[model samples]
Target: MSVPLTVCISAGEPSGDVYAGMLARELLASEPGARIVGMGGREMADSGAELLIDIRDSSVLGLVEVARSLPAFLRKRRTLRDWIRDNRPHVLVTVDFPDFNLGLAAQARSLGVPVVYLIPPKAWAWRRRRGRIVAQVATRVLCLLPFAAGFYRDAGADVEFIGHPLVDTIDAYGLPDRRGAREALGLSDSGRVVGLLPGSRTRELGCLLPPMLDALDVVRESAPDAAAVVALSGSTSDASVAEVTAMATIRGARVVVGSTYEAIRASDAVIAASGTVTLECAIIGTPMVIAYRLSPLTYAVVRRLVRVEHSGLPNLLAGRRACPEYYQSDVSGRFLGSAVTELLVSDAARDSQSGAFSDMRAKLGPPGAMQRAAAIVAETARSWAHE
Candidate 1:
């Protein structure tokens, strides 16, 4: 409603923080004086957003974990709602965290502000009816996944599928040669390098890292010359970092902090936790075995709710076994080590997975997705500001 349109962004996850930061930088490049504010992690603050809350470090991903964090979630919701009511930003941009964000959008709508949903809840994956409900809350939906548009469109929501921000993110790395990257990190340049990304949450590190390291140990026994790197993400706790580094170091793998693309780049094959990191592995054209472990009760509770064929995003987007997924019961050191070894030892196996990576990348949309997304948000937010 004014020349310097105020935009509020809510991004509570590490992946979302990366996107929010990229989007914020793009927005600032175009609208230098505009006020950008909201909830995110260090990356968003680094991009010049006035962080009202930093929930990225504390993001969780399990059925039981969500239940445990409900109190803090509620407080965050109330704070965001009160801020929207009082400050009344021209446009509200929500990045994922659908359970929390849809409510924030509802509050922004109640105050007559335009809402732009970025990487909104994937109702197609489960609870299909919520997609229809989301259609009514946000003014425009910017989808990063290719199939995401049809879901919102079918529900009669305004939606556009900009190319995934990941492409742009990865492109910035310039696709360095694997040996050169490994050498740059001071790792052995000849042997197989396995990158281990055990997710980015406290519970994820707790539940997944031990087993992932166990798998790394199994690999070390067979290919003693092989190298490994346990890559910690932005959300990892100081305790988790210490644990992962110590454990991985004992298994002959060094611990690297938070350079995901470089980690993937340096590795020949990866044993990664199932999540957005799987997509990062795929984007880097690395063969991977994806693993996820949840609390037994949480696994039992949400097992039936999952509607997709593949648990990993790379496999899910491929609509087939683009990469192997070992869930709670299926996850074992043997299976994970064998998968990584298969990719490392066999050219045929690696080639097949590489083919699927190409297919997955095609489905991921084009590069410069953040700039495109920022353009859409800017146009919508500033449309009638001068009227």
Candidate 2:
């Protein structure tokens, strides 16, 4: 009898954890006898990957946060490297978290283990030199975006555009009934609802959310019947919610945690921090304004490196501004409020935006991305064993 194939995986943030979990589930279903081990969070562990390290311990963002956690991160890295060296798994699959995952890929490559990268680094966006490093280390790169495949292919890496996992996950939830959703949340169906998604990261909330709240106050003045609800990330602490909640209540706003989709579906419009949530809004056919602010140093560094003209997924995918964007210095309460108010009043604007969103969703292709990615990994492992 052939020995069961062993695979190791690693992810460094909540988003990565969710994606890793989905991939792990698919792998187990496709290859029932396979053994999976990894450094990830609750989601991946729940999906049956043996957890070696919890992702929370290493999920810091920004230069300052990483600097403060450097010693501990280094220690964790040493432990993970040792585990990889000792176990010699048939394959090491990395999902996002490029900084840590790239180093691990290199180590696995040196040990003659194949490395598969999902959601490969955004080298086209920044640090182009890293593309060469990826080409040297990764045996295969499974990309979510079509452009990402071209970028890696040009860099001499074997890359495939496997369609986006969001297509599979988001559609499964289906669209929420707007009036029913409003009633469930105790919000009046007659009033206009504006969804506020600050972000999942503490640093993002601290820097970007206060300005968003201030902007909502301006929005309320223009549209007196408009009510705002902040969608709290599951990863954010109660203390963080408290700060935003106090501010929101002072301005007559509502706070909803854990169910971001319901909040988004109920909203007449959305004011979201620029990231995956923008993609979610597009998928749900919600019109939105995308806003983001980074630390001064990080913003400056990113300005020089990003090759793309837009940051929001809706904007990037459409190759046009499907929604208003406020970033870095442009992310002021006044600017954001003006944008949101415009979206609230213009039916033509919302219709046009929603149309673009539908088109983008179609471009994302069909569901079952996780299952497809897993099947590829399983086939590769089986082929390696034969050789």
For model 2, state the Cα shift of residue 166 in Å: 1.2
The clash count of every prediction, one per candidate, is: 0, 0
Which 10-residue window of candidate 2 scores lowest in summed lDDT?
56-65
Candidate 2 C-alpha error for residue 176, in Å: 2.2
TM-scores across all candidates? 0.95, 0.95
* Alpha-carbon shift of residue 155 in model 2 (angstroms): 1.3
Error of 1 at 44 (Å): 0.7
lDDT tens digits, residue span 1-387, model 2: 177778898887877888899998888887758888888886898999898888753476765666677787677667777888998777889888887788888888888788889998889778898888899999888888877788999999988788889887777876559987787778998978888898877778788778888888789788877888888866667787888888889877899887788899999898899888898888888899999787788778878888888888888889998899999878888998988888899999899898898889877767777877887787767766667
lDDT of 1: 0.84
Question: What's the alpha carbon RMSD for model 1?
Answer: 1.7
Tens digits of per-residue lDDT, candidate 1, 1-387, equal 346768899998887898899889999888868888999998899998899999755888866778888999989988888888899888899999887898889988888888899998878787788798789998899998877888899998999999788887787767668877787678877877888888878777777777777787678777888888888875567887887787777777788886667788999888888878888888888889999888998888767776777778888788889787898866888888888888888899999899999999999987889888888898887763543
